[model samples]
Target: MELRQLSHFLAVARRRSFTLAAHDVNVVQSSLSASIRQLERELGATLFDRTTRRVELSPAGRALLPIARHILADARAAKAEISAVQGLLRGQVALGTIQMLTWIDLPEVLARFTKAYPGVEISLLEAPVDEMIEALRSGELDLAYLACGVDELPAALTVIDSDTEPLAVAAGPDHPLAGQPGVRLADLEAEPFVEFQAGTGLQTVVDRLCHDAGLKRRIVLRTTQLELLASLVRHGLGLAVLPVGVAHQAGLTAVPIIGNTADRTVALVTRAGHDSNPAVRALLDLLRPDPAG
Candidate 1:
């Protein structure tokens, strides 16, 4: 009828002696006997046949032994799962990021997180900033890494971490502006460009900068792949604007944008008022910079 009573029943059945069972279970013989008696009474079945010299299980006790053992095992497994999650031992986290993730050191963060919580499963999705925001709002993602101006984020999202880095102009080796210093946005007015698609954060920044400079861009191609953008710039398809780190890594000549040196802030975002799972919390803790470092 109760787990404690079932436990007592199991102990008695296994030892076939009230005195021995009580000793094995660290309980008084009288208490163990009373618990077993209560269990038999609640079930309306005799569980044991006892005499001065010997004790044996009745038919009902034999029938219930395996069932009781199974129930106890399942209860233990459930408690263990709860504890594992609470202790950050097991769980899953889904994180989203913009296409340009090279600047965030995401691989290092993930490596450390996996080392700390090996049982936790992690899924990483890459998309444009707009898509990442939508995924966060729809609960498809637990957290997102985004590159945008802080003011551009919606009110429903919360910024967890943010850092600003300079944006640079990328050009092929043979491009006329490859070695130029302090290249102004207006200088590229007549140059054809390869850029991210319209919905991306980088595209938004590009549009704003071009508008500010009063120059209409000549966009020859648009795609979501940063690698493709770099490839295009490499083969002289068109020039591109990208993060300074990304541009340098892609083997393109990176030059500073002069008059109005625009920079983008990369931020970690989560849905406002959403409760984070244990795995998500652990990752956020790791991503947070150490004050002592």
Candidate 2:
């Protein structure tokens, strides 16, 4: 009827002696006998045949013994799973990121955490910053990588600035602007640009840069995939503005927008007050700069 009752039943079933089972389970013989009596009364079946000389399993006791053992075992396993979640040993951590993160050194960042808590399994989903924010708000993602601002974050989530990488413009080696020096936005207005789909954080920065430079972009192609944008730039379809780290990782050349030195901060987003959640906290420790520093 209860896990404790089932546990006591198993101990008695295994030992076949009330006196021995009581000692083995650290209970008084009278208490153990009373618990078994209560269990049998609830089930309406006798679990043991008792004699002055010895105790043996009755038909109902024999039938319930194996079942009780299985139930006890399953209960312990469930408790262990819960403990592991608290200990950061066996739990699923759903993380979301923008496409640019696929190009960032996430493996290195993750390695620092995995080495310490290898039992936590990571599930990564790639989504744009906007979509990632939505996912985090909707509880679809346990954590997310995106530019930090939580105006749209559900009341339950927290945002922490993790790191920043400088943004730069990139082009193919054969592009006309490749060798140019100090080329302002006005000089490149005629060239087709490979841009991120509108509404992305990256595109917002690009739009801001173009606007600041008193120029309008000639977007020839738009994509939600950052890697594909880099590939298109490599093929000279158009130039792309991206984080310097991304451009470097994709084996593309990054040219700083002269006088337009823009940078975007990467932030770790998580369910608020889940700092107590071991897995999420472990990731946050890995993401943010050391507070001691």
Candidate 3:
């Protein structure tokens, strides 16, 4: 069918609500519904099931999602290449990022980039490192800021810029280990830990470090929110291993780990060949401005 129909279908599929999708696409609900209906009529398959309160994608919708995404991405890429040849930058640049960033000033950078390239549309997604890597590989994302360990980067992804921070054991002021200058990784084996959710970058780093050090922690609470994790540790639910900056911000005592160099690396990564997209390149220039200039 038409490209607009595919776009409408995707909006509904993503939002799971005609109302929300309509608002997202800046169209009336009736218009969005008509587009979907027209698309279904042409395809000869129902794209969504609207029997219940929550709208769910039908089997046909599920089958079309990836193909639709690929088509749109290709279309956007073609448009961007054409615009670049005409000495203009236009189209979409989708960037993914891990939730925590102690170093980057992303909002400020985005403000500048959007002001500079008003023609380009930007989408920012917060996800775990692994998921972002997959998104970059699948053409869903042009760039991702992720926490990766040394030499553990995905095969098809390459880095544009990177920063590293040391990890520390975070303990409340009242904890017995609070005053320690350097706590060994083994010391945390018997401690109850307040940990990040499994998919998070910090959680992944902490798990690998513990696994290598032959230490098993008794995780008392797991949370996706950084503030919640900090609160859990502060209220003595458990100790946590976090970046020094995060520990300091949360007002926890950060004790360095003896003989451990499990630093967290935040890298701006992209799929190997996808860096050629003009919109993505413009954002990259903002992300790492030339020092010589």
Which candidate's TM-score is highest?
3
lDDT of 1 by residue, 13-116 (tens): 76678987787567899999999989988999999998989999999989997787676645544543564557777776768777776655778989989998
Residue-level lDDT of model 3, residues 168-248, one tens digit each, is: 999888998888889889867788998887777778889999888878999878887888988888888899999998899
lDDT of 3 at 177: 85
Off by over 4 Å in 1: 1-86, 273-276
Q: Name the regions of candidate 3 deviating beyond 4 angstroms.
A: 1-62, 85-89, 289-293
> Between prediction 1 and prediction 3, which has the larger TM-score?
3
Model-by-model lDDT, in order? 0.78, 0.72, 0.82
The weakest ten consecutive residues by lDDT in model 1 span 72-81
Off by over 4 Å in 2: 1-86, 102-104, 111-118, 148-157, 290-293
Clashing pairs in 2: none
Instruction: Give one digit per residue, the lDDT tens place, for model 2 in 173-242.
Output: 8876677664667667788888887766677767877888887878889886677888999999998878
Weakest 10 consecutive residues of candidate 3 by summed lDDT: 82-91
What's the residue-level lDDT of 243 in candidate 1?
82
Pitting candidate 1 against candidate 2, the one with the higher TM-score is 1
How many residue-pair clashes does candidate 3 contain? 0
